[model samples]
Target: MSTPDTVTVDGPGLRDDPSRPGPVDVPALLAHSRETVGPALRAAVARLDVSSREQAEYHLGWVEADGSPGRGGGKAVRPALALLSAAAAGAPAETGLAGAVAVELVHNFSLVHDDLMDGDRERRHRPTVWARWGAASAILCGDGLLTLATEVLLEDRSPHAAAAARLVAVTTRELIRGQAEDVAFERRADVGVDECLTMAAGKTGSLLATSAAIGAVLAGAPTAAVRGLSDYGMAVGMAFQLVDDLLGIWGDPAVTGKPVLSDLRSRKKSLPVTFAVQRGGAAGRELAAWLAHTGEQTDAELRAAADLVERGGGREWAGAEARRRMVAAERALAGAGLAAGPHAELLALGHHLIDREF
Candidate 1:
């Protein structure tokens, strides 16, 4: 997984500065999201069986393994995007509440399943749901979240309620396909750049696109706005994933909450890995040899692979690709016809997304 730097929104600027902290206060934003989306999320999972509900709550960062309060949730980006999209369309932020909560639930659902498939045991500095409560509980918790996503939307009773439910379901399918492709890529030595990009779009872009589009749908925004926001979300998602891919290879372990070269150690075919492999250069050959002979990579071997990825032009190419996608996302957002206030925040977020140290 890609983990970028800690991002704080300071007004129109997405960059972090201690002197003149702008409006993109990440903590404030998350607090706002929790205020808006928390109630629905809680009620949705309230009916689950004791163990499943406990796991779900634990995964959501509401409680710990022993039912104590825990600081364990994600960045809440999807929900923020949904609410921001609604505001951009001149609707009250409250108007997109259901959409925001639903997307968040779906996001967590994917995280649970992905962790299990990857055999990952840690996230956000805590044991993964599967690690703490067995894989069965994790699976059941993910299913509960998925079902609750639709259930919450169904409770909205607006004209767009059914539509929102349908959109999430479809996006979830796309997410699953993307994840399947990612796992498949791990088994193949011949992964290509184009295929990797497609997988990134599928795995990461689909749900973000839904997050952006659902707000417009719920607010009864024009069809054009929805399409534009969807494209914008996809572009942002692509950039976000590329940045994440970069961090996977070179990110600071302290900031990312994962070991250095974690992706290489796990033998995952990230964009850089795939790009280097497809380069067919000396470095690419060396990297391939290391990969092919892998049982458990020593730290030194992982470092060597990272060096080879850079030497093969993978690092430079991914950085360039990330910048390109950032530009594309901005253009897409411009076409979204959002109000000036919301547009500024979203644009700043786009900037913040690409420029972080975590």
Candidate 2:
């Protein structure tokens, strides 16, 4: 949330032409998005019963477990993307505020449930809703958030609201499917990189795709342009997950709010891990054997496993793939006919997100 502004956009985009956009302040864009949609998001959550409201507020980083005031939510990237989509269509950013709130709601809803399902005890350096409260409470809270997401959009009187709501529903289904696949992968050692990439496309890409295009739907942008933005969002989402997979293995706990090599410790068949295992070399075999073992790994073992993943080319592959996806995102944006400023903003954001470090 405290990230700096002034992101220099990489990747080929409309900015390549001398008459087009300049550097975008991604942090300012994100901050403006938060200012635009955070209240709507909170007000929507306020509709939940008190029991659910407290848990929602806590999990949303609005308060501490003891109900004390606190400040920390994610970078609010989804909402930012939604609002930017509308701007790209030459509409008032406010036209996309509902879409922004709805996507943010669904995102947080998934986070609550995902934390419970993954047995993750911490988020944003605080105890997760399930860990601090109870699993039952966490489930109900997630349900409340998910329901509110649709309700918020449906409450809008815009002619396009229904279509946007429907899109959110469909995208949420894909997200759930991807999550299921991710969970199932834990029980099998035969997960392939292609399969893992497909899973990431669903789990992460679908929602982002919606976030990118839903604003256009709400603003009634041309169908082809909306489709282009959706395509751009998909590529950006894949890049994001690849970077996440890398962070899961090598992120700084002080920044990521999780232990180092956390995914390896859990034996998570992440994209990079899957790629490395499928690479089939000495390092790959060692990594596969380590993953197959059903015992808690030592600190040394975790570090060594991280090395094996790198040696097996998982780290390099993930990094290169992330860059490739960024390029794809830019290409999609170039043909989208988006307004120059918004197009520039979107491209800068994609770069900033995929290039993010923990």
In terms of TM-score, the best-performing candidate is 2
lDDT of each: 0.81, 0.86
Candidate 1 wrong stretches, greater than 4 Å: 1-26
CA RMSD, predictions in order: 4.1, 4.1
Query: Each model's TM-score?
Result: 0.91, 0.92
Error of 1 at 126 (Å): 1.8
| Candidate 1 TM-score versus the reference | 0.91
Number of backbone collisions per candidate, in order?
12, 0
Task: List model 1 lDDT by residue over 19-108, tens digit each.
Answer: 464455555655676777778778878978888888888888888777678765776888878887887787776778899989999999
Candidate 1 yields a Cα-based lDDT of 0.81
lDDT per residue, candidate 2, 1-358, as tens digits?
1223454543222222424445676676787778888889989999999988999998888888676786868889999899889878878667888999999999999999999999989887789989988999999999999999999999987799999999999999999999999898878889889989989998999999999888888999998889989999999999889989899999987766678888898888998898899994999999999888887778998999999999999999998998888888889989989877777778778777876574
Model 2 gets an lDDT of 0.86
| Model 1: ten consecutive residues of lowest lDDT | 9-18
